[model samples]
Target: MSGTVGPSAAQKRNYYLIVLSMISMFVTTSTIYMVFPLFFEEYGMSGTSIGFLISVGTFAGIVSSIIAGKYSDSHGRKPILFAGVAIYAVVFFLFAFMEKSFTMFAILRFIEGFAFYMTPVAITTMVADIFPPKQRGKAMSLYTMS
Candidate 1:
């Protein structure tokens, strides 16, 4: 056996739970990335328009990630994580059924970015909380692998 002790079972469980959430986040994001370009083009958005829309979403994510990190620090990470996931789910569902328009899509994409980003902020916090500093790097590596 190795000299170094490993994480306790509960620690392992929590770590996996966090990883699972990250995986869910990745899945939703990947699905959007795969589908949205085609959908936008089919909806008659020009190449520039599609690029602009994606940029708006990215900007929203950047802004929201900053806000969310502070909010989660004060209010706690779990609520932010759950709200982000919930909002993302709702937005993704709406995308499937909603009618198309540039304005509407832009608004949804903004919300989607805001929601999509909240998870990583809160999740990284949660991982920090669950794992001791010694294991944190490994935990994050596994988290990102999702």
Candidate 2:
């Protein structure tokens, strides 16, 4: 109860966590999204098929966001964050082994989308909990920027 109080320590920690979360988000999203265009020709995925691949991931992310947000609101942020990151790691590992099959790649991307959604929601909730109302806007903006 005697430790550092109010915005100082919390703000510093929240800033750091926000930065970490942003980096994680960017890396995860870019890794999944960027590869499609880079190797679509080699993979033989037509523009429509590539769009489907991206759409599946995005749809999964939307679903995951809804579920993760509710769970985090009820349970807490750390567990959701850990689970998301863990699943993300697993998905990336799986993606590394993707063969010529478009179906398998689509499935991997969808799962990755789900996992990626959890991290951002959890991190944003964590930031909201840590920062004051007046500062949350700035914190969220910074989180998005970085």
Writing each residue's lDDT as its tens digit, candidate 2 over 1-146 gives 12333467766776697687669768766776677576688887788998898799899999999999999989998888889888988988887777878888888888888988888888888777777777778878888876
Give the poorly placed runs of model 1, Cα more than 4 Å off: 1-8
How many pairs of residues collide in model 2? 0
Residue 111 deviation, candidate 2, in Å?
Answer: 0.4
Tell me, by lDDT, which candidate is best: 1
Error of 1 at 115 (Å): 0.6
Going through the candidates in order, what is the number of backbone clashes in each?
0, 0
lDDT of 1 by residue, 1-146 (tens): 12345567887887688788779778878877898778977898888998988998899999989999999999999899889899999988888887878888889999999998888898888777767777778988988889
For candidate 2, the lDDT comes to 0.81
Lowest-scoring 10 consecutive residues by lDDT in candidate 1? 1-10
Tell how far residue 27 is off in model 2, in angstroms. 3.3
Those runs of model 2 whose alpha carbons end farther than 4 Å from true positions after fitting are 1-5, 8-11
